[model samples]
Target chain A: MDIVILLYKGFTALDVVGPYEVLSRLPNAVVKFVAKQKGIIESEYSSMKMVATHTLEEIENADILMIPGSTTAFLNVVKDAETLHHVQRIDATTQWTISVCSGAVLLAAAGLLKGKAATTHWGLLDMLSKFGANPVAERYIQHGKIITAAGVSAGIDMALYLTKAVAGEAYAKMVQLIIEYYPEPPINISDFSAVPKEVEEAARAFFKKEMMKMNIAAAAMN
Target chain B: MDIVILLYKGFTALDVVGPYEVLSRLPNAVVKFVAKQKGIIESEYSSMKMVATHTLEEIENADILMIPGSTTAFLNVVKDAETLHHVQRIDATTQWTISVCSGAVLLAAAGLLKGKAATTHWGLLDMLSKFGANPVAERYIQHGKIITAAGVSAGIDMALYLTKAVAGEAYAKMVQLIIEYYPEPPINISDFSAVPKEVEEAARAFFKKEMMKMNIAAAAMN
Candidate 1:
């Protein structure tokens, strides 16, 4: 499988890293980090630098096309009509289009998810409808060739699900075991619903501004 | 705080990245990717290349020194006596030293965990006892200045705990919410005890050979 992952400035590293870890494990899978240019691109949150393997023009005939989300400048990039046009062109030829967190917003911005069901990070889920998508707030959602996962770390679930869908379940299970992905947390604070009211409120407040911007951007694109 | 994270060829991208996303969020925390040399280092599992910002010789007076785990070949680099000696020298000056997964083994080999309670990737937890550490099969273990987290993804939890311990609970909670780390998985297969017997057995079979090599390397270092 030839996978092309979009690496934009300010993307959440986990959003890209989680899926990359799983997809690259496939025996014959070829994963490419496609960016606006080839070289170092800095993520907004942590200032971690990722090296891009290929430029956007070099990526062609990919089995999977993935877009990872960011809290800072990713929305601005997706809102660019020219970039969205380029993504739309790529989506037309890709076998499967996948996204994590608000990356679904980019797919929706490209008019790929019109009238289709999709998902995004929970904080931004309600805004997905603005992009003409029937938003489903789940960890992982599959609507035909378009697959979206919720939040930053949920990309792992989406990747595993995609692995099962494209490769076999046996391969996906093997990858899961190899990564040792058993979720035993010391505290039960993983889900907003499970956490304290104050924690949830704080989280909502933290992301409210970004969600609003994404909502506005999705509407403008639609 | 000046934090230097060792970046080696074939290191697990998430093992470093998960903690990086959290640690870099701290106010006045300057995190640098320190490698043997400065340039791009390809991760073992994902093959994602990251650019190192500084060389090992450039790192001075680090408040925290972090080492991330990797696959077999990458893990072997840490076991090298010269590398261990360098790590030991750095550990002596750093206020706190930490490792994720088999990174603990490197600390042990450097004689940094001689009397510390430590842990590593659960699959290879048994090897820690050989390095004079009282190994615990937990997700995150902190014995004073030496902290160790279990396999690949657990680095995030360890980082959050460290953030709370150093910065304060409120700050860590804020960062956790911003990252939206409330994990809710459709499957409960993150640990050997939670996963199927067949899956556990298959993983053990696959990893046994690597674990044996780690044991031999640790013995040689001692």
Candidate 2:
């Protein structure tokens, strides 16, 4: 399997790293870190730098194309018309196209999620509809060739699901065991419904302001 | 807080990346990747390269020290007397020392886990005792200043737990929500006890052989 992962400045490190951890383990799988140019790339939050393996022009064949979200000034790079055009072109030829967290917004901008059910980082869900996608506030949403994972860490689930689909159950299970991904969270507040009223309200308010700013910026890009 | 993460060739990428995703998010945290030298570090399984930020000689004033495991031939690098001696010296001054997966074995070899309850990747738990640690096969184990996570992905849980301890519950919860760490496995086969007998046996056989080889290598190094 030939996998191409999009790497942009300020990209959320985990959104890509979590899935990369799983997908790169597949037998005979070739994972490439694809960016505009091959060199050092900075993470969205941390000052950490990751090296890209291939430039976008170097990628001619890909079974799966993944885009991971970023924060801070990195998000602006995704809004660039030239970059979105490139993503749209590559995604058009890929067998499976996936996005993690707010990366779904970029997919939507590329017209990949139009009229399709998709999801993103919780606070960023509403913007999906603006790009003609039906936003689903779920951990992961699979619509035919497009797979979108909610928020940052949900990329692991999407990767596992894709691994099972592409490599079979036995292979997926083996990888899962290696990762030891049996989650037992100390708090049961994974969803808004399960969280305290105050916590929920605070989260909602924080997202409301942030999402509005992102929406405005996304619109200006258009 | 100043954090130094050990970056060795053949180290498991997620073992470091998972915790990095969490700990780097802390408001005042300064995370540095410390290696024998600064350059591309290879992952154990995927053979992917991760860039290291600093050299061991440059490491000083670390509040937390983390060791991540790998399965590459590069394991020979850590076996050097100078490297192990440096690890022992720095570990003595760190406030909190931690390891993920087989990394705990390195800590134990350095005499850091002596008389401490620790854990490692389930497949290699039995070997922890060889390094003088009371090996506990839990997903995440914490005995005083030493914290060890099981296998590869459990580092995420351990990182969250550490975040809660240092930054408080509210901050940790906020980070969790941002990452959307609500795990829902499609299959119930994460634990050895939960998996089918055949699958479990197959995994044990595969890992046992690898562990034996690692044991011999580790013994020679010590």
Candidate 3:
């Protein structure tokens, strides 16, 4: 099976790595990291840099195509004509098309999430509706072959479900055992809705400021 | 704060990445991936390659030093006197020295875990005894400034605790909320001990075979 994970400047690391850790272990799986350009792709929130093995144009088909989200960088991706065209091109041939976190915005931007229930990073949940997607708050929602996971860490859960769908329950459980997928969060917050409203507002403001900065930087580059 | 994560050929992706996703977001945190060589480092089971930001020798001190695990590659790392010496040198200076999964084995081999209670991947818990370290099956255990986490995904939980220790509770919860880290595993297995004995045995056999293969490859290279 050929699995292609999309990458762009300022992409979130865990959004892709969490799913990669689980899905890459599938039998006969060959995973490729593809970006607009071949070489290093820096993350949005971390100093970590991953090497893109192939260019987006180079990969025309994938058994699975994964799109990982970013805080503000995804806005640029959603607005790019060439990238959206490629996402649509790949989606045309994939057996499974998945997005994590704000990545759903990119899929929804491409018209793939129209009339579909989807989920994304809590901060961006309402924005999905602007692109014709029904924003839900679940960990993950599968509408046909397109699976959209809630946030950064939700990709791990979504991948296990995808594994069960592609392979069998037995194989998925074995993979879970191999990774020791038992999660024990140390934080006291059980529900994101329960978080202080001020904190959520502050985070949203930070993201908005970041988007403005990204726009300035992009304009300067042009 | 300067955070240095050690990487090697065939290292597990999630062992380090899980923690990176959490810790890299700490206030004023700068996370660096370091290896013996400064270049692309490949994972044990995946085709993913990460760029090492600095060579091990270039970095002598870190506020936090993290060692991520590999299935068979860790055996090579433990056997190398130079690598063990570097680990010791870095551990001596770190405010916090940590390991994930079999990374505890590397710390143990370096004499840092001697007479200390630590934890590692469930399959290799007993191996810590060879280096005079006590192994437990908890998600993570901290002894003084050193923390050892169990298995792959445990690093996320361990990092949340470390965040609380360094930055306090409110900041940690904010970071947790930023990532939207509410985990919901799709697999039904709650406790690893409840897994069928055959499945665990099969996974162990697979690791052993991979270790043997790695040894043969090392011999050929030498």
Candidate 4:
């Protein structure tokens, strides 16, 4: 299996790695980190550097095409005609097309999520409707081969489900067993609804400020 | 704070990344991926390439030194004189010395876990005893400044707790909310003990075979 994960700055690193951990272990799996230009891409919140081993021009197709979510970077990618066009081109031939968290927003921006039941990060779930996507609050919603997962940490569960779909339940369960997919969160933070009102407000504020900054940066570059 | 995460070939990716999503958000946080060599190091299990931007020679001290775990890779690192020496040297100056999963095994191997209560991946919890470390099968056990978490996915929770220790409860909770860390595992995978006996047997068997392969590879190299 050839798993090609899209890499871009400002993406949530966990979204890429979570699914990568589960799917890269598939039999004869060869995972590649692909980006517009090769080199390192920084994670949004953490600013951790992840190297993109392949450029978009080098690899034209994927058995699985994964799009990881970002805070504001998703908007930049979606607005770019060439990148969005490339994503659409890949999705045309992909066996499985999936997006995690805000990545669904990008997928939706590419006209892929139109009329599809999809999900993204809880804080931004409502935004999906703007792009003609039916946003559900589930951890994952698999609407006919286009699997969309709810925010950051939800990607793991979504990947295991995808694994079951691709490689059977027994193999997926064994992979789960090996990784010991047990989670013990320090708080009861299941989704945006479960968080305090102040937290929700802060998240909204963060997103608004980030979007403004990204706009400024994009304008300055142009 | 300067947080240096030790990178090596065969280290578990999520074990390093999960906590990174939380800790890198700490106040004035500077995260660095450091290895013996300054370049890409593959995550042992999945072969995902993570770049090590800093070399062990370039960094002498860290406020927080993190050791991520592996399967048999931890054993190879434990036996490596220079790497163990560098870890011990760095630990001597660390305010917080921590490990995730089998990473604790590396700490124990370096004599840092001697007489210290720590934890590791649940299935291999007992293995810590050979190095004179008190293994506690909890999500994370913080004995003074030495903190260790149970298994792969447990690192995130441990880091949240670490954030509380380093910053405070409010800030930690805020970070938690930002990440939207509401985990919903498909299985009741709390720990090794919580798993069925057959699952444990299968895990053990899998580990045994991997070890055999690793040993064979080592012998072939010799």
Which candidate ranks first by TM-score, i.e. highest?
Answer: 3
- Candidate 4 local lDDT, residue B125: 74
Q: How does candidate 1 fare on TM-score?
A: 0.88
Model 1 misplaced stretches (Cα beyond 4 Å):
A204-222, B208-222
lDDT of 1 by residue, B1-222 (tens): 888898888788888888888788776888888887898888874448998888887765688899898766445775577667768777878877889888888888788888788988776676688879889888889888888988887888888888888887777777776666766544456565666677666656656655575565433222
**Each model's lDDT:** 0.78, 0.78, 0.88, 0.82
Backbone clash total for model 4 is 3
Indicate whether candidate 3 or candidate 4 has the larger DockQ.
3
Residue-wise C-alpha lDDT for candidate 4, range A1-222, written one tens digit per residue: 888899988888888888888888787889888889988777785436787888887877889999999777787787788778878998888999999989999899899999999998876777788899998988889999799998777888889888888887667766787776777776666666767777676656666667677664423211
Candidate with more favorable, higher lDDT: 2 or 4: 4
The model with the greater TM-score, 3 or 4, is 3
DockQ-sorted candidate list, best first:
3, 4, 2, 1
Candidate achieving the largest DockQ = 3
Candidate 4 Cα misplacement greater than 4 A, ranges = A45-47, A216-222, B45-47, B216-222
Tell me the docking grade of candidate 3: medium
The per-prediction i-RMS, to one decimal, reads 2.2, 1.9, 1.4, 2.1
* Candidate 1, residue B151: how far the Cα is off, in Å: 0.9
Candidate 4 residues B1-222, lDDT tens each? Answer: 999999999998888998888888888899889999987787884436777879998887899999999867887898898998989999988999989989998999899988988898765677788889998878888998899988777888999999988988767777787666777766545655666776666666767777787773433111
Tens digit of per-residue lDDT, candidate 3, span B138-159:
9899999999999899999999
Candidate 2 displacement at residue B184 in angstroms: 1.0
